[model samples]
Target: MIERLSIIGVGLIGGSLARALRAVGQVGEVVGCGRSGPNLEKAVELGVIDRFTHDPGEAVVGADVVFLAVPLGAMRGALSAIKDRLDASAVITDGGSVKGSVVADAVAAFGKVPTRLVPGHPIAGTECSGVEASFAELYRNRRVILTPLSETEPDALSLVSRMWEACGAEVTTMSVGHHDEVLAATSHLPHMLAFGLVDALARMRENDEIFRYAAGGFRDFTRIASSSPVMWRDICIANREALSAMLARFGIEMTDLAESIRRADGDHLLEIFERAKAARDRYVDRVK
Candidate 1:
């Protein structure tokens, strides 16, 4: 159990983690730190945290664990802010979608990667933002991937893994490279496609009517397009190498599919549809 926990960004992911730990009685004194004062006030009012601070350095004081839930773009600044104030033995982890950039940021900010710092990403969330959207059950039955470097302290990794497990998440560990490649294909690529499809349709003629007539399929596929653009922009840039490779392969496949459709190749279209349906059907239940 943790005595004091500091969360650098008290948004959906951070606030939800706080609530989850509170729900299990595994944590005490959650101090939320964020750029938005009003949002921090709201988190306090909602009982997501015991107190609030606008400064990351002040928030980490006396805390045994620090969780950085800020956007990928804000991570370096947050780390730099808390660098000198970090307790020598405090375990630090993050909810960044891209692990490589976070590891690099830690190295840059601290002169080297701290053995107590474990990079983690919880594979769960809605297309929502802010502390108000947080819930304790957000991570229930979800996977939380922890990427530990060779120098990472075993005790520190154990603390982080057990903390996530207490929050109802299945904790798993993998190399940072493997984690980034897999997430780029599974999560980032889908969000990119969803955003691209929605933006493309929005720019078409009679876009208003197009949206007005859009059905369940359109909404379901594009739901993630409603996610925070700033966060996604950073994610794309941070994981650009892996994400770009996936995007290139997808682009080639789309071009071939379009050409086949333009040629009125019903057989080709049927084959593609059948293959996709079979694949999705096999894995859709796992997602659900």
Candidate 2:
């Protein structure tokens, strides 16, 4: 029942949400705001939103719902700018990958308005950004994680959940801490690995040769490496504690693999490879 919605940052997630919301008739009006004048103009031209602005305060002034889709590091700054002007009854949510930090920052910036804040992460994206990259089906069949604190109003939480559900997403509730921890393993760690592997390979003496000889496998493996550097950098720093734990666990498993390879333990290596293959196969089967 959100009559007026404002989407801040108008990047891949925000733009996609705007497009999906319109397609699903989830809101009466959708407005987009971002720091980039050209991007806001593009969003308006793309018909993703009814209007666009560069002012956060003006964007959320009368909105019934507001989504902060900026990078995690920019969350605080954006919230601070719009804090005073946001509708008291508006359900303020965000698309930030990291939740704990964002929740804390938003609460600190907005004071008692924390009750209106609902932290969420839509487990959907592409290696794309800006209004031009957005599609109405970007969130179709995707899982949307809603991290609502005890202080969060039930009506606000329900509104946010229903909005995402109408956008073709499956909504589920989770704690902000648990959401951050799980994402650190599933999404954040994989991105880090992709970035590191690509960087290490590109810096080698045979870098150009490797690129010339690369096939679909290598290309697919490094495809996410091309994602926005600023966004990934912010996510890495924002969730460093959880990411560090995941990295340490991965390192231990990697060390065991290396030890088996060094010892030429073919049987153990085969078992490990088989298990991994089976695990992936199981996931594929489930998806199908």
Candidate 3:
């Protein structure tokens, strides 16, 4: 169990982890650190954290576990701020969506990927933000991927894995590059497409009518477009290499679909749709 857990950025992911740890009695004290006083205070009032602070260094002073849950862009600064204050035995981890860049940021901040630093990403979230959007059950049955570097200590990795497991998450490990590439294709690209589609539709001349006539399909598809723009922007930039490649591949697929429709190639369109449906169904079944 973690005697003291410090979360640098008490937003949805961080708050949910704190709540989950508390719920399972896996943590003794939860300290939240963030730039927004109001949000940190809200996290404290919501009982997601035992205390709050604007200073990252102070927050992690004696923390046995430190979770850096800030945006990817802010990772370097957050890590730097707490690097000097972290206890010798403290285990550092992050909830960044992009792992490759996060690994680089940690190295940049500390001159190396410390054995105690474990890079992680939780494959669970809602179209919500802030502490109020968090709950203890957010990670229940969810997958938390850890990307441990060559320098990562086995004990540190095991501790983080167990922590996530205690929070009801199924832990998995993979190379940082592989994690980033997979996330770029599956998670980042979809969010990017959702945001782009919504933006394009909103700018149409018949935007009002388009929205008024929209149905559940549109709502369900674009639900993730409501995510924090700044956070998504940073993710896109951080994982640009993999994301760009995925985007190019998607563009080719879209072009093919468009041409099939233009040529009235019903067979080609049907084949593509059928394949997509089968893949999605299989994924849904596996998750269930």
Candidate 4:
């Protein structure tokens, strides 16, 4: 049972956590922190947090649990700002998509206290952002990945896991490296491809009709391209190694398909298309 929880960077992820935690009675109070005064004020007005502050120190004081929900690039600064104010027994966690860098930063910033840090990535989000866009049930039935290092304290891990579970998340544990690698293929690479495709087409004056016809397939594929540039940019840089490897693999696969099409190799094309269709059908059935 967390008596008090502090959420740094109270945008979509942070605000949603605060709201969901409160809805499930997982915490006695939720304090929000953000660099923007107006965003903090809006969060309070929206009741996403019980209290709001620009000072990370003020937000974290006496908190039994703290969640760093900012962009991956802002994480180090946010943790440093609140490190001194964190309760010695407080369990610090993050909602960062990449965990390896965040965990390393935590170790460097807090030294021995890093054992209390639990890095998490909730595979739940919309193309939306800000406190106004937050939904209390955003985490419901969603997967929350906890990348706990070998040195991470079991008690601290348990506390963080319980909090996410209370928010209606299905929690799973993975190594930081493995989490980054898998997410590179599933989430990061796709976002990169979407943005790249959109940007390439945007350079053409005749492509205005593309946006006009962006309903159905185009809409679904480019949904993630509409995500916050700041957030995605940070994620890309932070998980550069894993993302680069995945991108290289993706390029090889794309080349194979392109060659097949160029050669009019019907059998090869059919094999690739059939496998992709079957995989997608399996995933859809399981999800349903």
Candidate 5:
């Protein structure tokens, strides 16, 4: 159990983690730090955290663990703030969407990667983004991927793994580069597509009619368009290299599909649809 846990950026991710740990009696005290005073107060009022602070340095004073839940662009600032204040024995982890950028941020802030720092990303969330959107069960049945550096401590990795397990997450580890590439294709690209689709539709001359006549399929595919733009913007920029590669590949496929449709190639359309259906079916079955 963590005697004291410090959560930076106590919005959805951090607040949910604090609530999860407290729910299981795994944390003695949770200190939340964020920019908003009211949000911090609401976290305390909701009992997601035991206390609150605006200073990242102060929040980690006696914490046994520190969870960085800020956006990728803000990670360096937050890490720098608490770098010298963290307890020597405190284990640090994160819920950053991009592992590679986060590791770079830590290295830049600390002048070296700390062995106790475990860079992680949880493959879970709703299209919601505030303290009110947090829940103790957010990580339940979800996967949390940790990208630990070669110099990372074994005990630190184990401790972070156990904490996620306690939150009902299945923990796994991977190389930072591989994790970034995988997420760029799976998570980042999807979000970008959703946002771009919704934006393009909204800007059309028949936007009102299009939106009014939109069906469930459109809503389902673009649901992630409603997620926090600020956070997604940071993630896209942080993983731009891998994301750009994925986007280019997807664009090529889109061009091929468009050409097939223009040529009225029934076999090409049928084959592509069949492949997609089978892939989606396998994915859904595995998820279930």
Candidate 6:
């Protein structure tokens, strides 16, 4: 069990982790660090953290484990703040979606990727934000991916693996490049498409009428568009190369679909639809 845990951003991800650890009685003291005083107070009131501070350095002074749960863009600043203050033996990990940028930030702050630093991403969360939206079950049965550098200590990786397991998440490891590419296709590109579709529809002349007649399909497909724009903007930029590749592939598929419709190729359209449906069905069965 972690004796002292420090979370550098007490929003959805960080607050949920704290809550999960508390529920499982795996962490001793949870200190939440954030720039927003009101949010920190709310986190304390909700029992998501034992205490909070605006200073990241102070929060990590005695922490046995530190979770940098801030946005992708804010990672460098958070890492810099706690760099000198982190205990020598402290295990440093993060919930940032993009591992390459996060590893770079850690190297910038610490002069190298410390053996104690392990880059991780928890594949969970709704279109929600802030302390109030967090819950203990957020990571339950969800996948947590770890992309540890070659310099990472085995003990550090094991500790982080166990920590996520204690939160009821299934942990897996992958290379940093592979993690970025997979997440770009599976997560980032979908969010981008959702946001772009919703935004395009909203700008149409008959937007009000269009939305008024919208159905469950539109609502479910665009649910992720409600996520924090700033966070997604940072993610898109951080993983731009991989996301661009995915977008190009998606554009090619869209062109093919459009051509099929123009040619009235019913068989081709049916083939595409059937393939997609079967892929989704297999995924659902695996999850079940």
> What is candidate 2's lDDT per residue for 69-116, written digit by digit as tens?
999889999999898898779889999999988987887797754888
Which digits, one per residue and each the tens of the lDDT, describe model 6 over residues 1-288? 999999999999999999999999999999999999999999999999989899999999989999999999999999999999988999999999999999989889889888999999999998999999999999999999999889999999999999999999999999999999999999999999999999999999999999999999999999999999999999999999999999999999999999999999999999999999999999999999
Q: What is candidate 2's TM-score against the reference?
A: 0.97
Residue pairs whose backbone atoms clash in candidate 4: none
Alpha-carbon runs more than 4 Å astray in model 1: none
Q: Which has the higher lDDT value, candidate number 3 or candidate number 4?
A: 3
TM-score of each: 0.98, 0.97, 0.99, 0.97, 0.99, 0.99
lDDT scores in order = 0.96, 0.90, 0.94, 0.90, 0.94, 0.96
Name the lDDT of candidate 1: 0.96
Clash count for each candidate, listed in order shown: 0, 0, 0, 0, 0, 0
TM-score of 6: 0.99
Compose the digit string of candidate 4's lDDT tens values, residues 1-288.
689889998988999998898787777888888889888889888888888888888899999999999899988888888888878898899999999889877867777548889999999999999989898899999999999888889999999999999999999999999999999999999999999999988887978987787779988898899999999999999999999999999999999999999999999999999999999999999988
lDDT of 5 by residue, 1-288 (tens): 999999999988998998899889999988999999999999999998888889999999989999999988899999999999989999999999999899889999999999999999999999998899999999999999999999899999999999999999999999999999999999999999999999999999999999999999998999999999999999999999999999999999999999999999999999999999999999999999
Q: Which residue pairs come into collision in candidate 3?
A: none
